[model samples]
Target chain A: MKKSILITGGARSGKSALAERLALSRSGRAVYIATAEARDDEMRDRIAQHRARRGAGWTDHEAPLDLVGTLDATDGDAPRLVDCLTLWLTNLMLSGADWRAAGTALAEALPRQTAPVVLVTNEVGSGIVPDNRLAREFRDAAGWLNQTIATACDEVYLSVAGCPLKVKPDDVSL
Target chain B: MKKSILITGGARSGKSALAERLALSRSGRAVYIATAEARDDEMRDRIAQHRARRGAGWTDHEAPLDLVGTLDATDGDAPRLVDCLTLWLTNLMLSGADWRAAGTALAEALPRQTAPVVLVTNEVGSGIVPDNRLAREFRDAAGWLNQTIATACDEVYLSVAGCPLKVKPDDVSL
Candidate 1:
């Protein structure tokens, strides 16, 4: 039962809610891994909203950078939900860490987990090309990251307007 | 039979390629309704690249604004492929036109089409929210448009790395 699922969508596309549902579906209790840091008021508000929605039946862990370590340590009977990989990448990028290597390591680490790991990410490359070079570079990296992680996962889905559309392990080829 | 399809994804996610395949899947020759206007060298180059990839059997039509009318005009023997809806929306917004009204009109016009129509659009809302107000507004409009068009379409797909995953007319809820 290696239920390694990657859920990706736009901002406010209901990815976290869906991930929460899947994480708690099999087991009433699950582990919540927060990759986001509340550095500002906006970030704090978002984090609070997510926390409020997730309510109970969840043990939370803050793993902004050391996601692999968090996953390895949390390996047990309870399923783990990484609310996002994008923020983890952002943290790595901002800290001058090798994000490519980090992303690869996470993909490599997915298969060995004893507990179900439901990861979430954002789709940032589909819009018009950004005017700034950094935004362009970030979007490019995000797209590549999504493709790499998707290749390693057991299942992948793209959420739209709060609806999940399974993409990987699907019959249709792109 | 009416076969209106909406194809959406991020940049270089293989949206246009998938739209072309679907457009020609039923008819050997299909009308290419491009909403893009070659106002500059970059845009011209991109348009040329698309044209080169499409190769033969495509009758090109430029309707940067009047897409609903273009669809009606091209409803004859060949199926029509609107290379994008996002660009059309951009044109409308830039011109200070009521894009919401136009988007709704396009959706309403889809059901009355006698010929098959394959509309391509971008998924712009999946990324980090833009820092600028205009980009934010555009992404919001694009997301609303995608959902609206999808509601009217017989099929809706999200392209990923050159693969097509059907989202509409499927049993998978959400």
Candidate 2:
């Protein structure tokens, strides 16, 4: 069976970079599933930077809100790397999409894929509680999303300071 | 030799709870050094909740600032759990204290302690980049602080969804 790996860490903790590296390590074609939308200049710049970093050799798919559908459509032979889930959550919240339904769809769709999948998610629960309601809601939703996705994954890694620590399978040799 | 353990996680990922549990697991007195200040009703209620949760067998020390002095004065035989370093960072930022210097002081003081210490900290770098400079600065400072403290500590665990993942001593069995 193809394996699903989840990589989580704080901002700029080299999570996405690690995910990219993992995707490249696998055989066959690589697919990059980008969940970020270029809503502003900063975001646009960040997306551009990511594109530059990934270089050539990977297919890019922008599915800010249609993650399940995109994953369903990808070729089974190609390994898929979902760069992040937090921004997808933000997009869902902003678009007024039902989080539970989207999360359910993601959970149900993941196992159906034939290709190996590597997911990158932000571990946002270790910080101070946000002062605003929206931020708090996002934090809670993100936490739920991470837990749900992590449960479905065959391997989970918590990235810190550019190091990847295998979290799941609890006894796996790193 | 006394051991210093650093526990890091996102907002409500059970980092503090795990630290508290660790403190309770050890023999001797448990000292909880709280860094939060009850500046508002919300904060006061949160503090009250923590107090109620800890309940009875622990010594509480409120040190929004002067963490070094408080640690210096604590009984050497008791286990000390600083149920977070992030808020202390906020307090320092608000009070115009030098974060680098304070972090250096903490790094220096932790090794000299006689009692086993468990420090809870937020892994704030994994989220979306804050839109403002101050928040960005805080994120960078917090990351640096975690790295510095983790370097000095004997053990490091990254908490997530109430589960503790041992990160340091890479070969130790979890």
Candidate 3:
């Protein structure tokens, strides 16, 4: 059976760990799709931490901002873990690719996947209003991206303070 | 009078033209906040086209994702044009910056801008639904960003195929 789940939460809320753990629950050659760019020490540390936690024997793919192409390149029923969508969108936006082209590329690519997918993203909507125009734009985009992914996934989870709350059922009998 | 307007549209839909035209209407200086990263020849051409149009006497600042800093750095009552937000957001995401932190920063910075700000962005929500996980996320983020900017701006315009339509009114009184 084809299964897809979306995992999201606040920063340092353990969303990535939880998504990886969930992907490991099923037995297969799990693939990790990392979208983050190591632009600083802190980010490098975070990426290292995720890498260390995942350990060996996992196929790691660093396809920043090209999720659709990466998804299409992979072969098998193995569970695919897209580390996060927030950074992926960021990469695309910075590369001068309009949001619609990115979205169209992404929306058109999801249905062709032959494996169960687990996607991770940041939950940023519930917060104080941003101060600058660009920040507000990011918040709006992140919120909208989360909603779109949640709508497409069969199950959705909200992680806060390292705790996971299932917003959708994981019933396999359906 | 300090006037701020956010311009949004699809790719190559004359957003830059509208933004430059709007910025020229004001005094002080015209500051261009460019968010694009020239990844290829096409992007280079696009950026060149915009730069060529701006002509001489325009100070160009490349603030890919640091909107707050850009806004803060500019001294009083100057006319500023943020060429686009879509690319800026992508830069932030790829750089591993927390979406909320970045959003908060931008939101806080806009109101303090002394210039009549003309912000440009792409409207990506009207397109076909995203099929893949990554594209869907981008679509959602772009939609939210537009909504947030429209809400924050005194005036908003939606550009389609090089034609401009006023979606919001100018709040600055002469």
Quote the lDDT for B22 in model 3. 79
Candidate 1, B1-174: lDDT as tens digits: 347999888876678877888788775789999999999876897799899999899999999999999999889868899988999999999989999999999999999888899999988875566888989988989989999999999988877744578777788666
Cα TM-score of candidate 1: 0.61
**For candidate 2, lDDT tens digit of each residue in A1-174?**
237888988788999989988888866459999999899999999999999988877999999999999998995787899978999998898899998789878977888888888999987765445658777768878887887787788888888899997777565121
User: Considering only the true interface residues, what is the Cα RMSD of candidate 2 after superposition?
Assistant: 4.8
Candidate 1: lDDT of B84?
89
Q: Candidate 3 — which residues are off by over 4 angstroms?
A: A169-174, B1-174
Query: Judged by lDDT against the true structure, how good is candidate 3?
Result: 0.72
> Which candidate wins on DockQ?
1
DockQ, per model, reads 0.23, 0.18, 0.02
Model 1: docking quality category: incorrect
* Tens-place lDDT digits, model 3, residues A4-39: 778876678888888878877778458999999899
Error of 1 at B104 (Å): 20
Query: Per-prediction interface RMSD?
Result: 3.7, 4.8, 18.6
